[model samples]
Target: MLKWILFALCIVGIYFFFFKKPKTIHEKKEHKKDSIMLECATCGTYVSSDEAIIQDGKYYCSKECAQC
Candidate 1:
């Protein structure tokens, strides 16, 4: 009886340490989508494509920079 109980506890410990811990750690990681980068035509600053302003075939960091 004692041997069976010890074997069960060992199996549970192994399962928790090897399987459960890694699953939770992987699930908690934040995955960000890839973004394109473009250099500002005025100041030469790099900005993400989504936030950049496009004008006359050039990319700008902001509306003010685009006008300049």
Candidate 2:
């Protein structure tokens, strides 16, 4: 009975140590970005694409520049 219990334990230990797959839970990946800059057509200044005004297919830093 003792030998059977010891053998069973050894087998269980080996199976657990060797056969089990490691946790693959990856951490949430952080994203990256640098805002794209577009040059204003009238002022020749660079503005972030998100905030810049688009007019006549040209980028402008502000509404005043866009009207130019």
Candidate 3:
């Protein structure tokens, strides 16, 4: 029983190491590159600088938030 368990663990480890998808790692790196998180002046919600609306040196998550 112990030997079978060890074998199963080894098989699982090998599969995880060799076949695990790297899509998430790549996506995280891409999203984090040249971008930063900032707080909205109105609602105080945090948003990526790349997608946030910048007005008067304040970052906003949406146009409505910036309007405030």
Candidate 4:
């Protein structure tokens, strides 16, 4: 039983190491998109670049902040 468990684990590890799908370019870009940090121009709140609004070369966390 122990040997079978070890073998199963090894198989699983090998499968993950060799056959696991790597992130595609689009997926990697999407991940990078979320990782970017931007500060709100008005309230100074930090937000993800993807969620921030850009206006007049400044980033805002929301529409209200952008208007301010």
TM-score of each: 0.50, 0.50, 0.50, 0.51
Candidate 1: Cα lDDT at 45 = 96
Which one is best on TM-score? 4
Ranking by lDDT: 1, 2, 4, 3
Clashing pairs in 3: none
Worst 10 residues of 1 by lDDT: 22-31
Better of 1 and 3 by lDDT: 1
Could you tally the backbone clashes for each prediction?
0, 0, 0, 0
Model 1 clash tally, residue pairs: 0
- For 1-68, candidate 4 gives per-residue lDDT tens digits of 99999999999999999877765646543344445889999999999887999999999999999998
Give the distance in Å from residue 12's predicted Cα in candidate 4 to where it truly belongs. Answer: 31
What lDDT does model 3 reach?
A: 0.87
Highest-scoring model, lDDT = 1
Residues 1-68 of candidate 2 have per-residue lDDT tens digits of 99999999999999999868666557556545567999999989999988999988999999999887
